[model samples]
Target: MLPFTYALRNLFRDPARLLQTVGGAALVVLLLIAAVALNEGMNSVLENSGSTKNVILMGKGSEESIERSEVPLSAESAVATSVRGLQEVLGVSAVSGEIFYQAPLHIAQGKESQALLRGVLENALLVHRSVQLIDGRFPQSGEVMVGHLAHRKLGVAEEDLAVGESLYFGDTELKIAGRFIAPGTVLESEVWFDRNDLAVLTQRDSLSSVTVRMDAAEFEDVEVFTLQRNDLELAAISEQGYYDKLSTFYEPIKVMTWVTAALVAAGALFGGLNTLYAAFAARIREMATLQSIGFTRKALFVSLIQESLLATLTGTLVAFILGYFILDGLAVPFSIGTFTLTLTPSVIGVGLITGVLLGTIGTLPPAIRCLAPSLPSALRSS
Candidate 1:
């Protein structure tokens, strides 16, 4: 058996090969961490965006996109009165009739970008219990409030959307009255306006959707209301159900991301294997000499694995360091809103597992081929 120091010392014999092995493993592990983090972040944000206690009432056949759904302005009051057992805060019904729109918003000194707009009355805070005002106050008529992460979606400097700043919605200039945050939810990437103000700006009288918070009531109760009131032409879906549907809607994108990571990982795997092949082939004669002195082939194989693991583990550590600084808490903007990428425990576990696989599996083909030669054939010629 070879001493552990023997394997460790051999790694420095060829600096370039060691670097290649380390870099390849780092790239593969980084990609795995990023891909998993991306999918998880997106899914987490979408899941958190909805609550079990809430139901969305929208126009039938428009459940896929709330922006396309329109409910009569009367439905807001009607649901508050009709849906018994709905949540109540200070005697006010926990109902929010909102107008959802996505349009280019112009910042004074920044570029125009498409931003999610949600028009809601003050009662929206009651329904969306996650929302908390971090600065200033709720928006009033002719004013708006920006979410803490809205600047990421708006493609502007954070100061551009700061309280006291103004944004242009088409030809109308709206003041930034405040900033709020809904942690882990897509709502943090939206701009909220007074319902009447947005209706006037978009020139629509109908509400996009009406959201209600349930207490003693259940989803079936909300569904029954929609079914019983055929005149409203509305559909009822639990908020959680709605976002779950949305997650599937973006499934193809996630699949594409996975495919891309797989391809890159495949490339890195082959590249690392090639590096190991070259590095190990040069040591065949040394291995043969060791065997002649009674070092078993199995022992030499274990030594090679140890060396490979050292390089790969080193690379894994580097990847995690870089990911922590670059990927963690990073805001990533998507169609609905921006989600934050984080280095959760699950992401770290994925990275460590990937590194181990690369160290073990990726080393097998090259290691076996290097040690496969007959003893006499290998010893005679160099």
Candidate 2:
């Protein structure tokens, strides 16, 4: 058996070739990792937005996004009184009526941009713990709470977002009372206000949807009742399932990722194969000399494989560190939406496995082809 050092030294013999082959492989691995992480991060953003005990009540045909749905505000009292197993706090059932709208917000003095508007009661915040105020106080009626991302986009500092500062949206002058954060979720792109205030502002006394906090036992009853109700055209679904539907919102992104990864891997695999074939072909005489001196073909193949594995593994390690520290945390800007790329444990595992697999698959054929020559021919050629 050859020493591992012998195989490694051969790979480093031509620094330029080593760099090119490893770099290409690393680039492929990085691209794959980025795509996987993006999917997971987006999934996480949606998945983490809801709790298992919470149920969303939307118009019968509506899915997760309430912006596209409409439900009468009176539906709240009906669900509270009708749905059995519904818990209560302070005399109110574990249900909250809410409204969601998209409003044009003028953050810049002379420019206007659009932002999602969410209107819910104080009790709604208690039910959805994801809404955390990082600064100031919660917004009162005629006031608004901007999300952390919204604040950054608007270039509004905590001090600048005073309780009395006016935010002009449509004909309403909304007061800035607080700043809240729901990290990694779509909520970060919204401004929140009181439900009643929003109803007056938007001129829609009706709500977009209703959210209910029910026990595990209540989910079935609530779902069945909401669906079967003759008076109201409403449906109930798990909040998690609702957001999972948003994955379609990211369909183009997911497709683009898969296509880009396939192309990159294909290019990298071919480049790696070419580099390995050339390197092994040049060493035919050397391999033959070793064979004549008692080195087995199996041993030569193993040595070449080890060299390929080492290079790929090195590149994978470097790429992982770079992707996590530099690329993953970056906030990618887009016209439709923006999110930070994240690298989780699953992504790292995939990248490493891909690198090792690329190494084994790319170099095996070339190594075997070079080793096909007889020992005598190799020695004579040498």
Candidate 3:
């Protein structure tokens, strides 16, 4: 068997080749980390954004998008009185009629871009239990409260959406009354408006949906109500179910992300393979010499694998360091909201496994070919 020091010593024999191997592995591993983290971040946000105990009541045939749904303004009152076993706080039912809108909103003396808007009453907090008012007061008439991460979605500076600033919706100017956060959810990227104010500004006479929080009520109760209330023409769905469907809807985005990363990594992988082939081809005579010295072919092969592993593992370390600094806690904005990227245990595991596979499987072709020639022929050849 080759001594551990033998493989270590051989790694530095060609500084240029060592650099190429390490750099290629680093680039490939980093790309994998980014791709996996991105998908995880997106899925986490969408999955955590909704709750199984909550049910959304939207207009018939509008289950896919609340923004397009239109329910009568009286639906909120009807659900509260009709639905049994609803959650309540101090006798106030946990029911909220809300309007969801997306439109171009202008900052005070800044750019205009599309922003997600949610119109709700104070009781909205009852249904969206994750919401926490971190600053100032909730929005009243002529006022709005921005989500803590809303600026990221709007592509504006953080200070632009701070409390005391103002946002413009057409000719209407709404004061930024506060900042709130709903961690791990899409709500953190929306701007909340007073229910009345939003209806007036958007010229909406109807609501997008009514959200109800259940305590002892089963989903069947809600579905039964929808069926009984034929005149209302409502659709009942669990909040968690809605988000799960949204995850399925975004499946293509995840696929595209992986495809793009694979394409870029493929280029780097091929370059690394070519480099390894040349480096190993040059060492054929050395491998043959070791085999002739009573060392088994398997032992030489193991040493070559050790060298490759060392370089790839070093690159993997580099990738983890970079990912921690750059991707961890990074906020990524999408159509619905923002999600933070973290180097979670799953992501790190994937990266480490990828590094190991690249070291072993990626080295096989060149390693096998390098040892293929007989000891006599290898010794005679260059």
Candidate 4:
């Protein structure tokens, strides 16, 4: 059997080829890391956005989209009084009637972009435990509060969303009274206004949804209330269940991410294979000589695989460093809100496994072809 050093030394025989192989493999691993990070970050945002103790009551057919759901303005009071076992916060029933809207918000005199708007009463803070006022005070009528990432989503400078600055809604200007944060959730990318102000601006006569916080064991009571109130035409869903459904709805996008990674990785795989083929073909005589000296064909094949793995593993290290420094914690905006790309341990594990597969699978065909001929034939050919 050949010494392992033989495989290691062979990799440096052609510096340019070694660099190319490593670079190509690194790029492929990086693409895979990006894809996996995207999936992880998106799922994390949606999963953390909900709580087991909360329930959402939305229009019957609009369970999937709270923004499209509508309940009567009277339902808020009715549900608070009718629903039993709701958690109380600061002497108020933890029930919030919310209105969701998306429209072009004027950032400047002429520039405007779409932004998510939420209308809620003071009880919103009680119902959504994740929300915290980071600056100034909660919004009042004719004023609005901006989320931490609202400026980024609106394509405006962060300074433009400062506490004293103002944003336009339709023909009316609303002051930015405060800034709030809801880390790891989509709420960080929205603008909040007084429910009455939003209803007047959008001419919306009904509420978007009713959110309530209650004991998990008492969810049946809430469900039964929704069932009995045929007049409201509302459906009840646990907050966690709602977000889980949202995650499922976005499954195809994650699948598409994998598909895109596969396509790009396939291209890089061929390029790496071509490099390996050339590198190995140049070492054919050396391999034949080794075989003649009693190094078994099996040993030679193993050495070839070892050389490929070394190059690919180096590339994998570079990919991890790049992912940690550049991609991790990078905020990516979506229609609902923004999520930060996370380089979690699981994502890194996927990248490492992908690197191993690339090294092993990529070397098989080229290694097999290079050793196909007899030792004498291989030595005599070149």
Candidate 5:
């Protein structure tokens, strides 16, 4: 068997080729990381947005979109009185009638971007355990609380979303009263305001949804209530289940991201293959000489693989470092909300596995072809 050191040393024989191979592999790995990160971040946001202990009561036909749903204002009271095992906070049932609106928000004198706005009552905090006021105070009339990633979604600077700053929602100018965070959830990209204030601005007389906190065991009661109340046209769904549906709805987009990455990586693979072929061809005579010295073909093949793996692994390391510094925790905005790309354990595992596969698969054909000829022919030719 060839010593591992022999394989390692051979990589540096032509520094230019080594760099090119490593650089190509690094680019491919980086692209794969980005693709995986995008999908992971988006999925994480949607999956974390919901809580199993909470239930959302939306209009029956608009189960897919809370923004389009319209539940009667009286449904909140109905759900509280009718449902059993609902959580309570300070003698008040943990129920919040919310209004959701999507509108263009003016963040500066001339800048505007589309944003998701949620209108919440005080009890909203009790039910939304993921949310926490990190700065200033909760919103009041003519005031709005921005999410941590709201500025990113709004295409504005962080300073523009600070407390005391003002933004325009339609013709209404609202002050930024606070900043809140709902970590790992899509709520981190929304603007929250008083329900009545939003109702007035959007001229929405009806609530979008009523969210209630209850035990999982009591979900059937809420569901039964929804089914019994034919006049209300209400539907009950677990908050977690609602977000799961959203994730499923966006699955195609995530798949397309992977497809795009695969296409680009295929191009890189082919480019790397061509470079390896040339490099191996140049070393045919050297390999034949080693064969004459009693080195088995399998041993030579293993050494070539080790060399390829080393270069690709180096590239993978560079990709990981770049992803951590440049991509991780970076906020990306989409139609619904913004999500921060994270270099999670699973994503890192995928990147590492992809690198190993590239190294093994890209080197095999080239190495085999270089060793195909008889020893005497290889020695005579090159």
Candidate 6:
């Protein structure tokens, strides 16, 4: 076994070369961490949106998107009456009919943005517990309730959100009466309005979806009855399942992560190999001295590999510290979702393993080259 100080000293012998190798490995680890964090962040967004006790009913032909589904208003009433095991809080049973629309909104700040519009009845807040009032008042007939992210992006403050302040969307101008927050869900990026007002404005009389709450223990019976109705053609699914299906919308992202990782690794591997070869090139006399002292070829090779591994481990530690603080809390927006990068335990593990493997694999060929010659031959060349 080599002393820890020996490996440490060997790496720092050529400060420039050591830094290059470490920096290359560090950059690869950083890219890997960032990629995995995105997937985890997206998963968190969807998982938080899902509730085990809630069920979503959409038109039969629609696979995942509520925006594409159009359920007749009469179906909501029929499902409510026939569905057994429906949970009720207070006197009202836990069922709500809702509509979804997307439109280009002209910000009062002189910027044009497209936002998803969700039209809800009075019990929306009660059914979705995450919805909380942060300011002003609830929506009146012609008013809108803005989400936190919407407020931030649209530059609409609570003071600016008065009962009669008009916002132009296409040919319509809706008033802003309140602001709400629903944490850890895509709802935070939407604007809520009265269903009747939205339907009139959008020229759609039908609802988009219906949500019902039932006892988790009785989910089996409720699911069977809800889907087996002879007159209604609809699909009923757990809210969790519905959100999980939404992952398909971002499927390209997972593939993109792997592709980026592979590219970074290829670059890192080449850079690491070059640095290790340069380090060995400079230490030709040192290898000759080791051979003269009866240190076997295998020992010399192992020492070089260990030296490379030490340098990479240092970089990985630095990257972990930097990535957790600098990369986390970064919010990136897209048409379908907004994600904040996060480094979970699994992500960190992957980064570390990648760095170490790059170090070991990059050093092997150079280490073998350094050990192949006779002591007199290597010494005579320098």
Model 2, residue 125: distance off in Å is 1.3
lDDT of 4 by residue, 177-222 (tens): 9999998999999999999999999999999999999953378888
User: Which residue pairs in candidate 1 collide?
Assistant: none
Model 1 regions more than 4 Å off: none
Ranked by lDDT, top first: 3, 1, 5, 4, 2, 6
- Poorly placed runs, candidate 2 (over 4 Å): 109-112, 151-167, 170-173, 224-229, 248-252, 331-340, 379-382
Instruction: Give model 5's TM-score versus the native structure.
Output: 0.97
Worst 10 residues of 2 by lDDT: 330-339
Q: How many residue pairs clash in each candidate?
A: 0, 0, 0, 0, 0, 0
CA lDDT, every prediction? 0.93, 0.78, 0.94, 0.90, 0.91, 0.77
Deviation from native of the Cα of residue 250 in model 3, angstroms = 0.5
List per-candidate RMSD values in Å.
0.8, 3.1, 0.9, 1.6, 1.4, 3.0
Cα lDDT over the full model 5: 0.91
Q: Per-residue alpha-carbon lDDT of model 2 for 313-341, expressed as tens digits?
A: 88898888879787777655333234667
lDDT by residue (tens digit), candidate 3, 1-382: 9998999999999999999999999899999999999999999999999998999999999999989999998889998999899999999999999999999999997689889999999999999999999999999999999899999999999999888999999978999999998989999999999999999999999999999999998899989999999999999989999999999999999999999999999999999999999999999999999999899989999999999999999999999999999999999998989999989999999889989988999999999999999989999987
Model 1 lDDT per residue over 49-104, tens place: 99999999999999999999989999999999998999998899999999999999
* Regions of candidate 5 where Cα sits further than 4 Å from its true position: 215-217
| Residue 18 in candidate 2, Cα distance off native in Å | 0.8
List TM-score per model, in order.
0.99, 0.87, 0.99, 0.95, 0.97, 0.88
Residue pairs with backbone atoms closer than 3 Å in model 3 (clashes): none
- Of 1 and 2, the candidate ranking higher by lDDT: 1
- Winning model by lDDT: 3
